[model samples]
Target: MRGPASLQGRLSLWLTLGAVLLWAVAAAWTAVHLRHEMDEVFDSALEEAGQRLLPLAVRDIIGREEDDSPDQGVATLREHDEYFTYVVRDAEGQVLLRSHRADLGVFPPFSGIGFADTATHRVYSDAALRGTITISVAEPLAHRWDVAREALIGLALPLTLIVPASLFGVWAAVRAAMAPIRRFRAGIEARGGGDLSPIPAEGLPSEFQPNARAVNLLLDRLRRALEAERSFTANSAHELRTPVAGALAQVQRLIVEAPDEDTRSRARQVEAALQRLARLSEKLMQLARAEGGRLQAETPVDIAPILRILVADMGRDAGGRLEVSLPDAAVIAPIDPDAFAILARNLIENAMRHGAQDATVRVSLSPDGVLRVVNAGPVVPPEQLARVSRPFERGATDAQGSGLGLAIVEAIATGTDGRLELTSPATGRADGFEAKFATNRIETK
Candidate 1:
């Protein structure tokens, strides 16, 4: 059979089992020893009774002044169950005196002095007056068995209470001893992939301290590596931004100055390529910001104004294709304004870039801090929709842009303990795409 699955249960079970086994062994040994001692005491009692009764029986026979051939029974003043009985006999094997309840059949032929065992009784015989007068004391074996049984029960009764108490004590001690490990596990689980702070290894037992130290060391290495990567990304993007913008401006100038149609068209293509590079670099910087440190503000603030400004800028560029709706009351939240803006911008841009060119994009923020951006477009397949949020993964649409939009929004949501969900077909719409962000960690009022 399988033992307990958990460490605490196994420890308590085995300890309790060991204690019960030891108790059982001790009790058995004690009972055997007790029975031996009891036998010695009972035998001594029988011997003493025979010796003391022999003289008194001789006196009674002599004082009777009657030459008796048949047995003479001693009279009893009260009625009781006599466990021990005795008989006085002559050398000729004639019973001269007997106890009130003595059965002559139980007394065997006396061979010599000391203890003897009959089938039904333990007989002790003694003689006086040169072996002519003899007395035998017989005690029933059943009476001895009864006494032994009661003594054995006395040794066992306390176990009923002791067993449960021992189990409880074992469980309590094991739980207390494992408390530090439990705390360590809770600390690790609470990190949830964002927080890489090392877990403290204090108060752990010697055997478990090494494991705790190893886990903390691993977390430290991961934290350093991630920080370095984010720093590299931010640096590369920041360095590329100025040159890419300058290149795009030069290409635009060349497109206007080119002498032939083919040359002008080629310059226009170069300008588009440079513009793509600049946007890609910008997306990379946003991704770095989204993946780095804290994303929440020190206190809650109304983020409605930031949303309005972004919608106006994006709408003006899109030729009035963007539609926005903001709550009348404050959309109070702890999310940092910059992070929220980046997230909102990415969602809005992704919808515009992927949706039909002339279709309207709907952006709205509910009173409870849920941002929904829906665009009229072809429904994305289930399998393709699943991976669209990954870096560098874009839809099959021919629109040109960096694919870090959804990825950035996802990172910000994860860091801020919010959720971002995308649907291929927008809820309550026949054919569209929807991105919903829930910052439930906000004040609704």
Candidate 2:
């Protein structure tokens, strides 16, 4: 046979087999009980026959002592049918009377007290003679078999109808139980790759409730990932297109129009724009790589050395607005040097862009491992301070620059389990933003 394709069919088969086994046991027990009942009825009939013969035989014995009318009453009783064999033996072990008439010998020896009888079902006892009388009765083995067959028929006929009905019921129950899973599968298969939405949980079994919730959570994560990737692509394209388009326009103008020095100077301006774009692209890529968690080569970086290097590099751009307060001791912390450089560069550059030409920018490494950067300018408001660290966010004075610098610095700080604090120090005395890195992380080297 081809096996069941659905859970319904399988469940039906298992239930039917179980029911059949139970029915077989029930039939066996019923047959045994019926045989015992029939045997009891047959043994009762034999006991009654023994009781009737007992009284008459005792009367005949008493009459034989009065000189003998030939005991015709006993002879009359012997003319009956041979359904049962009976014998009466004297105390001396001689046969006195037998229902068989002829000498078939006394009925086989039987155990007795008064009227002790043994049947195939069990034994029965009642008073028979003054001394003792015994009766051993048993129906044929074939009769017991007939009783068992009749009992089996009575027990099995009802089960024949009930078993099939039970199988059908189980099959239906199994089908109903599996319906929810099938529906879930169908719903999932109907969706396309672009469709990322929560699955409905209603009408499902309790066990499958978790599955629905898990799928919804996965969909939420997938939606967020897709949004992030799309934003990244758009931002990359826009950032790249501005520089490429400007460079192309500059090259076109240079080729098509060979005018005077002013025209050539305009070309140089375009060239500068291209250079700025290139720098921005390179910085963006660096920020991406750092935030992508790919930089693993971390070593001890001295804050003193990084500050000195950044001051030297930005000095020409700084227009002499920079000041440094060096500690007598070198301060070092464990960090990826490139990431640390990026962090320092952004902070110094932000200060240079926003601070006035006469405004002083101070860099210092604290003994407790904090690197403090303070610049002289208008202090950022408390509410707007947090805005500066968000990507693409800029302060009012920072319109000319791409707003990624503070965000990149914050990323580096967070990666190192460090904090970047922003505060508006007192005007004239501390008139600008203060960015502090933790001092406890500082290492003396």
Q: On a 0 to 100 scale, what is the lDDT of residue 388 in model 1?
A: 91
Please, what's the RMSD in Å of model 1? 3.6
Could you tell me which residue pairs clash in candidate 2?
368-439, 369-439, 369-442, 370-439
User: What lDDT score goes with residue 93 in model 1?
Assistant: 84
lDDT of 1 by residue, 1-445 (tens): 9999999999999999999989999999999999999999999999989888998998888777655655889999999989889999989888989999999999998788988897889999989889898999999999999999999999998888879999999999999999998999999987744689988778999999889989989998998999999999999999999898888888888988899999999998888888888888999999999888678889988888889999988887888888889988988999999999999999999999899888999999999899999999899999889999999988888988788999999999998899999997999998999999988687877
Q: Enumerate residue pairs that collide in model 1.
A: none
Residue 412, model 1: Cα distance from true site in angstroms: 2.2
Q: Write the per-residue lDDT of candidate 2 for residues 195-301, one digit (tens) a residue.
A: 56676667788988889888879878886786577459447946796767777676667945857877777777776677667666756765664464422236666
Q: Name the regions of candidate 1 deviating beyond 4 angstroms.
A: 65-69, 72-82, 92-106, 118-121, 140-142, 301-333, 355-382, 422-436, 439-443
What is the C-alpha local distance difference test score of candidate 2? 0.66
